[model samples]
Target: MFTHVDAIAGQLGRGLLLTLAMTALAFTGAVAVGLVVAVLRICPVAPLRAFGAGYVTVFRNIPLLVLLVLFVFGLPDLGLLYPLFATVSTAMALYWAAFVCEVVRSGVRAVPRGQAEAARALGLGFGQCLRHVILPQAVRPMVQPLGSIFIGCALSTSLAAAVGVAELTGQAEFLTLRYDQPLTSFALTTVVYVALTLTSGLVAGRVERKVAVVR
Candidate 1:
Protein backbone atom coordinates (compact mmCIF):
# COMPACT_ATOMS: atom_id res chain seq x y z
CA MET A 1 0.00 0.00 0.00
CA PHE A 2 2.79 2.44 0.92
CA THR A 3 4.40 2.46 -2.50
CA HIS A 4 5.18 6.12 -3.19
CA VAL A 5 7.43 6.41 -0.17
CA ASP A 6 10.19 4.47 -1.87
CA ALA A 7 10.19 6.82 -4.84
CA ILE A 8 10.32 9.84 -2.51
CA ALA A 9 12.77 8.48 0.02
CA GLY A 10 15.31 11.16 -0.80
CA GLN A 11 12.78 13.92 -0.35
CA LEU A 12 11.43 12.40 2.84
CA GLY A 13 14.93 11.84 4.12
CA ARG A 14 15.76 15.51 3.57
CA GLY A 15 12.60 16.47 5.34
CA LEU A 16 13.46 14.17 8.21
CA LEU A 17 16.88 15.75 8.50
CA LEU A 18 15.34 19.20 8.58
CA THR A 19 12.88 18.05 11.21
CA LEU A 20 15.67 16.63 13.35
CA ALA A 21 17.74 19.77 12.94
CA MET A 22 14.85 21.96 13.95
CA THR A 23 14.05 19.72 16.91
CA ALA A 24 17.62 19.51 18.16
CA LEU A 25 18.23 23.21 17.79
CA ALA A 26 14.93 24.15 19.38
CA PHE A 27 15.45 21.70 22.26
CA THR A 28 18.88 23.09 22.93
CA GLY A 29 17.44 26.57 23.20
CA ALA A 30 14.57 25.28 25.28
CA VAL A 31 16.95 23.71 27.79
CA ALA A 32 18.82 26.96 28.22
CA VAL A 33 15.71 29.10 28.52
CA GLY A 34 13.93 26.55 30.70
CA LEU A 35 16.91 26.31 33.06
CA VAL A 36 17.00 30.07 33.50
CA VAL A 37 13.25 30.27 34.04
CA ALA A 38 13.39 27.35 36.47
CA VAL A 39 16.21 28.96 38.44
CA LEU A 40 14.38 32.24 38.49
CA ARG A 41 11.21 30.57 39.69
CA ILE A 42 13.03 29.29 42.75
CA CYS A 43 15.45 32.13 43.30
CA PRO A 44 15.38 34.26 46.44
CA VAL A 45 14.60 37.40 44.44
CA ALA A 46 10.87 38.01 44.58
CA PRO A 47 10.68 40.04 41.39
CA LEU A 48 12.57 37.43 39.41
CA ARG A 49 10.35 34.71 40.77
CA ALA A 50 7.27 36.66 39.76
CA PHE A 51 8.68 37.16 36.28
CA GLY A 52 9.37 33.48 35.93
CA ALA A 53 5.88 32.57 37.08
CA GLY A 54 4.35 35.07 34.69
CA TYR A 55 6.40 33.72 31.82
CA VAL A 56 5.33 30.15 32.48
CA THR A 57 1.70 31.05 33.01
CA VAL A 58 1.57 33.01 29.79
CA PHE A 59 3.56 30.87 27.37
CA ARG A 60 2.21 27.55 28.55
CA ASN A 61 -1.34 28.77 28.08
CA ILE A 62 -0.86 30.18 24.58
CA PRO A 63 -1.39 27.91 21.56
CA LEU A 64 1.85 26.93 19.89
CA LEU A 65 0.36 27.68 16.44
CA VAL A 66 -0.23 31.24 17.53
CA LEU A 67 3.36 31.50 18.67
CA LEU A 68 4.59 30.17 15.33
CA VAL A 69 2.49 32.73 13.48
CA LEU A 70 3.85 35.49 15.65
CA PHE A 71 7.42 34.49 14.94
CA VAL A 72 6.85 34.07 11.23
CA PHE A 73 4.76 37.17 10.49
CA GLY A 74 4.43 39.39 13.54
CA LEU A 75 8.15 39.76 14.17
CA PRO A 76 8.92 40.89 10.67
CA ASP A 77 7.01 44.12 11.11
CA LEU A 78 8.83 44.62 14.39
CA GLY A 79 12.13 44.66 12.49
CA LEU A 80 13.10 41.24 13.79
CA LEU A 81 12.85 39.29 10.61
CA TYR A 82 14.62 35.96 10.84
CA PRO A 83 15.20 33.26 8.27
CA LEU A 84 12.54 30.57 8.16
CA PHE A 85 14.54 28.03 10.18
CA ALA A 86 15.42 30.56 12.84
CA THR A 87 11.84 31.71 13.04
CA VAL A 88 10.44 28.22 13.52
CA SER A 89 13.17 27.19 15.96
CA THR A 90 12.66 30.23 18.19
CA ALA A 91 8.90 29.80 18.32
CA MET A 92 9.13 26.08 19.10
CA ALA A 93 11.86 26.58 21.68
CA LEU A 94 10.11 29.36 23.57
CA TYR A 95 6.76 27.57 23.41
CA TRP A 96 8.21 24.42 24.98
CA ALA A 97 10.43 26.25 27.47
CA ALA A 98 7.50 27.04 29.70
CA PHE A 99 6.74 23.36 30.15
CA VAL A 100 10.37 22.41 30.56
CA CYS A 101 10.80 25.11 33.20
CA GLU A 102 7.92 23.73 35.22
CA VAL A 103 9.36 20.24 34.98
CA VAL A 104 12.70 21.49 36.27
CA ARG A 105 11.08 23.55 39.02
CA SER A 106 9.32 20.44 40.26
CA GLY A 107 12.61 18.63 40.37
CA VAL A 108 14.15 21.49 42.32
CA ARG A 109 11.29 21.37 44.78
CA ALA A 110 11.77 17.63 45.17
CA VAL A 111 15.16 18.35 46.70
CA PRO A 112 15.15 18.43 50.47
CA ARG A 113 15.37 21.77 52.26
CA GLY A 114 18.25 20.46 54.30
CA GLN A 115 20.44 20.23 51.23
CA ALA A 116 20.32 23.95 50.66
CA GLU A 117 20.74 24.65 54.34
CA ALA A 118 23.80 22.42 54.53
CA ALA A 119 25.32 24.23 51.56
CA ARG A 120 24.64 27.51 53.29
CA ALA A 121 26.37 26.11 56.37
CA LEU A 122 29.42 25.79 54.19
CA GLY A 123 29.22 29.56 53.57
CA LEU A 124 27.93 29.19 50.02
CA GLY A 125 25.73 31.84 48.44
CA PHE A 126 22.37 30.92 47.00
CA GLY A 127 23.72 30.50 43.48
CA GLN A 128 26.63 28.44 44.68
CA CYS A 129 24.35 26.37 46.82
CA LEU A 130 22.17 25.59 43.81
CA ARG A 131 25.22 24.94 41.68
CA HIS A 132 27.18 22.75 44.07
CA VAL A 133 24.55 20.99 46.16
CA ILE A 134 20.86 21.35 45.44
CA LEU A 135 20.79 21.23 41.64
CA PRO A 136 23.23 18.40 41.39
CA GLN A 137 20.89 16.23 43.40
CA ALA A 138 17.75 17.68 41.84
CA VAL A 139 18.85 17.02 38.26
CA ARG A 140 18.69 13.25 38.55
CA PRO A 141 14.90 13.15 38.81
CA MET A 142 14.63 15.83 36.14
CA VAL A 143 16.00 13.57 33.41
CA GLN A 144 12.71 11.78 32.77
CA PRO A 145 10.54 14.88 32.72
CA LEU A 146 13.03 16.70 30.57
CA GLY A 147 13.10 13.80 28.14
CA SER A 148 9.34 13.82 27.74
CA ILE A 149 9.26 17.55 27.32
CA PHE A 150 11.87 17.32 24.58
CA ILE A 151 9.90 14.62 22.81
CA GLY A 152 6.93 16.94 22.77
CA CYS A 153 9.23 19.65 21.54
CA ALA A 154 10.31 17.43 18.65
CA LEU A 155 6.73 16.64 17.71
CA SER A 156 5.78 20.27 17.96
CA THR A 157 8.06 21.13 15.06
CA SER A 158 5.31 19.96 12.73
CA LEU A 159 3.57 23.22 13.46
CA ALA A 160 6.44 24.95 11.71
CA ALA A 161 5.22 23.60 8.38
CA ALA A 162 2.63 26.36 8.22
CA VAL A 163 5.52 28.77 7.94
CA GLY A 164 7.11 26.71 5.13
CA VAL A 165 9.80 24.88 7.11
CA ALA A 166 9.33 21.62 5.14
CA GLU A 167 9.50 19.37 8.20
CA LEU A 168 8.29 15.77 8.28
CA THR A 169 4.55 16.32 8.38
CA GLY A 170 4.78 19.08 5.85
CA GLN A 171 6.66 16.88 3.46
CA ALA A 172 4.24 14.06 4.00
CA GLU A 173 1.31 16.27 3.12
CA PHE A 174 3.06 17.55 0.07
CA LEU A 175 3.88 14.07 -1.11
CA THR A 176 0.34 12.94 -0.39
CA LEU A 177 -1.07 15.58 -2.72
CA ARG A 178 1.58 15.09 -5.37
CA TYR A 179 1.13 11.35 -5.63
CA ASP A 180 -2.59 11.34 -4.86
CA GLN A 181 -1.91 8.67 -2.28
CA PRO A 182 -2.73 10.03 1.14
CA LEU A 183 -2.93 6.55 2.65
CA THR A 184 0.49 5.41 1.61
CA SER A 185 2.27 8.68 2.25
CA PHE A 186 0.82 9.30 5.69
CA ALA A 187 1.12 5.65 6.74
CA LEU A 188 4.87 5.79 6.27
CA THR A 189 4.96 9.12 8.04
CA THR A 190 3.10 7.60 10.97
CA VAL A 191 5.56 4.74 11.16
CA VAL A 192 8.50 7.15 11.21
CA TYR A 193 6.96 9.25 13.96
CA VAL A 194 6.16 6.20 16.08
CA ALA A 195 9.72 4.98 15.69
CA LEU A 196 11.10 8.33 16.76
CA THR A 197 8.88 8.55 19.82
CA LEU A 198 9.66 4.97 20.79
CA THR A 199 13.37 5.63 20.49
CA SER A 200 13.02 8.70 22.69
CA GLY A 201 11.20 6.70 25.35
CA LEU A 202 13.79 3.96 25.27
CA VAL A 203 16.64 6.42 25.68
CA ALA A 204 14.84 8.16 28.51
CA GLY A 205 14.33 4.80 30.20
CA ARG A 206 18.02 4.03 30.04
CA VAL A 207 18.95 7.41 31.45
CA GLU A 208 16.37 7.15 34.21
CA ARG A 209 17.52 3.70 35.20
CA LYS A 210 21.17 4.65 35.19
CA VAL A 211 21.06 7.94 37.05
CA ALA A 212 17.68 8.16 38.77
CA VAL A 213 17.93 8.34 42.54
CA VAL A 214 15.23 6.79 44.67
CA ARG A 215 14.20 9.49 47.04
Candidate 2:
Protein backbone atom coordinates (compact mmCIF):
# COMPACT_ATOMS: atom_id res chain seq x y z
CA MET A 1 0.00 0.00 0.00
CA PHE A 2 2.42 2.60 1.19
CA THR A 3 5.15 1.06 -0.92
CA HIS A 4 3.56 2.47 -4.03
CA VAL A 5 3.35 5.94 -2.51
CA ASP A 6 6.67 7.12 -3.89
CA ALA A 7 5.88 5.97 -7.38
CA ILE A 8 2.39 7.44 -7.11
CA ALA A 9 3.86 10.69 -5.86
CA GLY A 10 6.21 10.95 -8.82
CA GLN A 11 3.45 10.18 -11.28
CA LEU A 12 1.11 12.61 -9.55
CA GLY A 13 3.71 15.36 -9.82
CA ARG A 14 4.13 14.76 -13.53
CA GLY A 15 0.38 14.70 -13.98
CA LEU A 16 -0.04 17.97 -12.11
CA LEU A 17 2.69 19.58 -14.19
CA LEU A 18 1.06 18.48 -17.42
CA THR A 19 -2.32 19.67 -16.19
CA LEU A 20 -0.89 23.08 -15.32
CA ALA A 21 0.77 23.45 -18.69
CA MET A 22 -2.37 22.42 -20.55
CA THR A 23 -4.54 24.69 -18.43
CA ALA A 24 -2.28 27.65 -19.07
CA LEU A 25 -2.21 27.10 -22.81
CA ALA A 26 -5.92 26.36 -22.99
CA PHE A 27 -6.90 29.37 -20.87
CA THR A 28 -4.93 31.80 -23.00
CA GLY A 29 -6.23 30.33 -26.25
CA ALA A 30 -9.81 30.18 -24.98
CA VAL A 31 -9.79 33.79 -23.84
CA ALA A 32 -8.34 35.00 -27.11
CA VAL A 33 -10.72 32.96 -29.23
CA GLY A 34 -13.68 33.84 -27.04
CA LEU A 35 -12.92 37.54 -27.20
CA VAL A 36 -12.82 37.40 -30.97
CA VAL A 37 -16.04 35.44 -31.15
CA ALA A 38 -17.73 37.75 -28.66
CA VAL A 39 -16.72 40.79 -30.67
CA LEU A 40 -17.94 39.17 -33.84
CA ARG A 41 -21.26 38.28 -32.27
CA ILE A 42 -21.82 41.91 -31.40
CA CYS A 43 -20.31 43.50 -34.46
CA PRO A 44 -22.28 45.62 -36.87
CA VAL A 45 -21.58 43.24 -39.70
CA ALA A 46 -24.57 40.92 -39.95
CA PRO A 47 -22.67 38.17 -41.70
CA LEU A 48 -19.91 38.14 -39.12
CA ARG A 49 -22.40 38.09 -36.29
CA ALA A 50 -24.18 35.15 -37.87
CA PHE A 51 -20.92 33.33 -38.37
CA GLY A 52 -20.00 33.86 -34.74
CA ALA A 53 -23.37 32.57 -33.61
CA GLY A 54 -22.98 29.48 -35.76
CA TYR A 55 -19.54 28.78 -34.40
CA VAL A 56 -20.68 29.08 -30.79
CA THR A 57 -23.70 26.89 -31.37
CA VAL A 58 -21.78 24.18 -33.15
CA PHE A 59 -18.90 23.98 -30.74
CA ARG A 60 -21.00 24.28 -27.60
CA ASN A 61 -23.33 21.52 -28.72
CA ILE A 62 -20.56 19.01 -29.42
CA PRO A 63 -19.19 16.92 -26.58
CA LEU A 64 -15.70 17.83 -25.47
CA LEU A 65 -14.66 14.19 -25.35
CA VAL A 66 -15.69 13.73 -28.95
CA LEU A 67 -13.68 16.73 -29.96
CA LEU A 68 -10.67 15.44 -28.06
CA VAL A 69 -10.86 12.09 -29.80
CA LEU A 70 -11.13 13.76 -33.15
CA PHE A 71 -8.10 15.93 -32.49
CA VAL A 72 -6.04 13.03 -31.23
CA PHE A 73 -7.02 10.49 -33.86
CA GLY A 74 -8.35 12.37 -36.87
CA LEU A 75 -5.87 15.20 -37.18
CA PRO A 76 -2.95 12.94 -37.82
CA ASP A 77 -4.77 11.55 -40.83
CA LEU A 78 -5.08 15.07 -42.19
CA GLY A 79 -1.32 15.62 -42.08
CA LEU A 80 -1.48 17.52 -38.80
CA LEU A 81 0.78 15.54 -36.54
CA TYR A 82 0.40 16.73 -32.98
CA PRO A 83 1.97 15.17 -29.94
CA LEU A 84 -0.36 13.93 -27.21
CA PHE A 85 0.18 17.04 -25.09
CA ALA A 86 -0.34 19.42 -27.96
CA THR A 87 -3.41 17.62 -29.23
CA VAL A 88 -5.01 17.53 -25.81
CA SER A 89 -4.25 21.18 -25.08
CA THR A 90 -5.55 22.36 -28.45
CA ALA A 91 -8.74 20.34 -28.20
CA MET A 92 -9.45 21.53 -24.68
CA ALA A 93 -8.85 25.13 -25.67
CA LEU A 94 -11.20 24.90 -28.63
CA TYR A 95 -13.86 23.12 -26.62
CA TRP A 96 -13.73 25.65 -23.79
CA ALA A 97 -13.66 28.59 -26.15
CA ALA A 98 -17.29 28.01 -26.98
CA PHE A 99 -18.35 28.43 -23.37
CA VAL A 100 -16.08 31.42 -22.95
CA CYS A 101 -17.59 33.02 -26.02
CA GLU A 102 -21.07 32.68 -24.58
CA VAL A 103 -19.90 34.07 -21.22
CA VAL A 104 -18.31 37.09 -22.87
CA ARG A 105 -21.26 37.64 -25.13
CA SER A 106 -23.53 37.80 -22.11
CA GLY A 107 -21.14 40.23 -20.47
CA VAL A 108 -21.16 42.42 -23.54
CA ARG A 109 -24.93 42.39 -23.66
CA ALA A 110 -25.11 43.36 -19.99
CA VAL A 111 -23.59 46.72 -20.78
CA PRO A 112 -26.17 49.49 -21.08
CA ARG A 113 -27.05 50.68 -24.54
CA GLY A 114 -26.62 54.21 -23.26
CA GLN A 115 -22.95 53.57 -22.67
CA ALA A 116 -22.36 52.84 -26.32
CA GLU A 117 -24.54 55.78 -27.30
CA ALA A 118 -22.56 58.06 -25.01
CA ALA A 119 -19.33 56.82 -26.49
CA ARG A 120 -20.67 57.57 -29.94
CA ALA A 121 -21.77 61.01 -28.83
CA LEU A 122 -18.26 61.62 -27.60
CA GLY A 123 -16.88 61.03 -31.10
CA LEU A 124 -15.49 57.61 -30.26
CA GLY A 125 -15.42 55.17 -33.14
CA PHE A 126 -16.88 51.66 -32.87
CA GLY A 127 -13.55 50.06 -32.05
CA GLN A 128 -12.65 52.76 -29.56
CA CYS A 129 -15.99 52.50 -27.84
CA LEU A 130 -15.54 48.76 -27.47
CA ARG A 131 -11.93 48.99 -26.44
CA HIS A 132 -12.09 51.93 -24.05
CA VAL A 133 -15.63 52.12 -22.74
CA ILE A 134 -17.79 49.06 -23.37
CA LEU A 135 -15.65 46.03 -22.55
CA PRO A 136 -14.14 47.48 -19.38
CA GLN A 137 -17.51 48.11 -17.79
CA ALA A 138 -19.08 44.98 -19.17
CA VAL A 139 -16.25 42.77 -17.98
CA ARG A 140 -16.42 43.88 -14.34
CA PRO A 141 -19.67 42.10 -13.62
CA MET A 142 -18.41 38.97 -15.40
CA VAL A 143 -15.40 38.47 -13.13
CA GLN A 144 -17.03 35.73 -11.08
CA PRO A 145 -18.39 33.79 -14.04
CA LEU A 146 -15.10 34.10 -15.85
CA GLY A 147 -13.43 32.74 -12.74
CA SER A 148 -15.76 29.79 -12.95
CA ILE A 149 -14.62 29.27 -16.50
CA PHE A 150 -11.02 29.11 -15.31
CA ILE A 151 -11.96 26.48 -12.77
CA GLY A 152 -13.83 24.56 -15.43
CA CYS A 153 -10.78 24.59 -17.65
CA ALA A 154 -8.70 23.29 -14.78
CA LEU A 155 -11.18 20.51 -14.19
CA SER A 156 -11.39 19.73 -17.85
CA THR A 157 -7.70 18.94 -17.81
CA SER A 158 -8.67 15.54 -16.48
CA LEU A 159 -10.16 14.74 -19.87
CA ALA A 160 -6.60 14.80 -21.17
CA ALA A 161 -6.26 11.32 -19.76
CA ALA A 162 -8.63 9.92 -22.37
CA VAL A 163 -6.29 11.06 -25.08
CA GLY A 164 -3.22 9.49 -23.45
CA VAL A 165 -1.88 12.77 -22.06
CA ALA A 166 -1.30 11.34 -18.54
CA GLU A 167 -2.91 14.09 -16.51
CA LEU A 168 -3.97 13.63 -12.85
CA THR A 169 -6.71 11.12 -13.58
CA GLY A 170 -4.44 9.16 -15.87
CA GLN A 171 -1.71 9.09 -13.25
CA ALA A 172 -4.19 7.95 -10.65
CA GLU A 173 -5.40 5.17 -12.94
CA PHE A 174 -1.87 4.05 -13.54
CA LEU A 175 -1.16 3.99 -9.83
CA THR A 176 -4.29 1.97 -9.22
CA LEU A 177 -3.15 -0.58 -11.78
CA ARG A 178 0.37 -0.75 -10.43
CA TYR A 179 -0.60 -1.03 -6.77
CA ASP A 180 -3.90 -2.86 -7.26
CA GLN A 181 -5.36 -0.30 -4.82
CA PRO A 182 -8.00 1.44 -6.81
CA LEU A 183 -9.77 2.84 -3.77
CA THR A 184 -6.69 4.50 -2.29
CA SER A 185 -5.42 5.85 -5.58
CA PHE A 186 -8.75 7.25 -6.69
CA ALA A 187 -9.47 8.69 -3.25
CA LEU A 188 -6.26 10.67 -3.35
CA THR A 189 -6.94 11.88 -6.86
CA THR A 190 -10.43 13.04 -5.93
CA VAL A 191 -9.09 14.91 -2.91
CA VAL A 192 -6.46 16.70 -4.94
CA TYR A 193 -8.99 17.68 -7.59
CA VAL A 194 -11.37 19.08 -5.01
CA ALA A 195 -8.56 21.05 -3.42
CA LEU A 196 -7.48 22.55 -6.71
CA THR A 197 -11.03 23.49 -7.72
CA LEU A 198 -11.83 24.97 -4.33
CA THR A 199 -8.63 26.98 -4.34
CA SER A 200 -9.53 28.36 -7.77
CA GLY A 201 -12.96 29.41 -6.53
CA LEU A 202 -11.50 31.12 -3.46
CA VAL A 203 -8.98 33.03 -5.49
CA ALA A 204 -11.63 34.07 -7.96
CA GLY A 205 -13.86 35.26 -5.13
CA ARG A 206 -11.05 37.42 -3.79
CA VAL A 207 -10.43 38.95 -7.15
CA GLU A 208 -14.13 39.53 -7.74
CA ARG A 209 -14.49 41.28 -4.38
CA LYS A 210 -11.49 43.47 -5.05
CA VAL A 211 -12.89 44.50 -8.41
CA ALA A 212 -16.29 45.15 -6.91
CA VAL A 213 -14.75 47.32 -4.24
CA VAL A 214 -12.83 49.31 -6.80
CA ARG A 215 -16.01 49.86 -8.74
Q: Go through the candidates in order and give each one's C-alpha lDDT.
A: 0.86, 0.86
- Give the alpha carbon lDDT tens digit for every residue of 53-98 in model 1: 9999999998999888877989998998779899889888888889
* Residue pairs of candidate 2 with colliding backbone atoms: none
Give lDDT tens digits, candidate 2, residues 90-193. Answer: 88888788888888878878888998999999999889999998888777677788888998999888887887888899998898788888998888888888
Candidate No. with top lDDT? 1
Cα lDDT, model 1, residue 203 = 89
State the weakest 10-residue window (summed lDDT) of model 1: 1-10
Error of 1 at 3 (Å): 8.1
lDDT, residue 91, candidate 1: 82
Which portions of model 2 miss their true places by more than 4 Å? 213-215
In TM-score terms, which candidate is top? 2
